[model samples]
Target: GAGVSQSPSNKVTEKGKDVELRCDPISGHTALYWYRQSLGQGLEFLIYFQGNSAPDKSGLPSDRFSAERTGGSVSTLTIQRTQQEDSAVYLCASSLALIGTSGRAGGELFFGEGSRLTVL
Candidate 1:
């Protein structure tokens, strides 16, 4: 069943123009995460994948941000040349983890209702 979902929840661009955000996870979960919260700021963990491991982007903040999680689920977060501090609110999380992956030892993450980036 679907759970996590994000998309143009709110996006207004114009600065450098370059955006692509979308995420839909929660069907057998394979561990996917991407976060970026501003306007009060506090959740900035750009990437993380489980299953094949080796997909942690170290909280991507520069390089115009980037993300991908194809087969393991659905994920997309690309900001090639946008600016304005890259606006904020692009949260996406998924986790049906078996007993591994993060805090408390991985097992908590089911968010999606974000994707709000405005840079104009």
Candidate 2:
């Protein structure tokens, strides 16, 4: 893929259902990020993965939210027991390097159109 790719561009699930969102980042990119944006709200950081370092999951809202990156390329975010409040646009982004590294002020990020999840 030429850019970040996310699956199931739109999903409507009943409350308490489980949903999995997938992201495939640009080839050779080392950093991947997951963000959530609710209606009329700003993007909320969910998780970050950089190379082999431990993923920064400080932004996960609860134990019901989890994510994993495999082979350093693909990633998946799982939301268990989804609630109406969980409805949002889940975005995935990839960067070649971490911000402020490699002489770059802030590395550029390639973002996917995002997966819109709606819990009814």
Candidate 2 residue-wise lDDT at 87? 98
Residue 88 lDDT (model 2): 100
Model 2, C-alpha of 31: deviation from truth (Å)? 0.1
Candidate 1 has an lDDT of: 0.80
Q: Write the per-residue lDDT of candidate 2 for residues 8-115, one digit (tens) a residue.
A: 899999999999999999999898889999999999999888974545778999999999898999999999999999999999998888655777543498899999
lDDT of 2: 0.90
Q: Residues 43-84, candidate 1: write the lDDT tens digits.
A: 888877774353567678787787777777787889988999
The TM-score obtained by model 2 is 0.93
Which ranges of candidate 2 are over 4 A from the true structure?
102-107
Question: What TM-score would every model get versus the actual structure?
Answer: 0.31, 0.93
Q: What overall lDDT goes with each candidate model? A: 0.80, 0.90
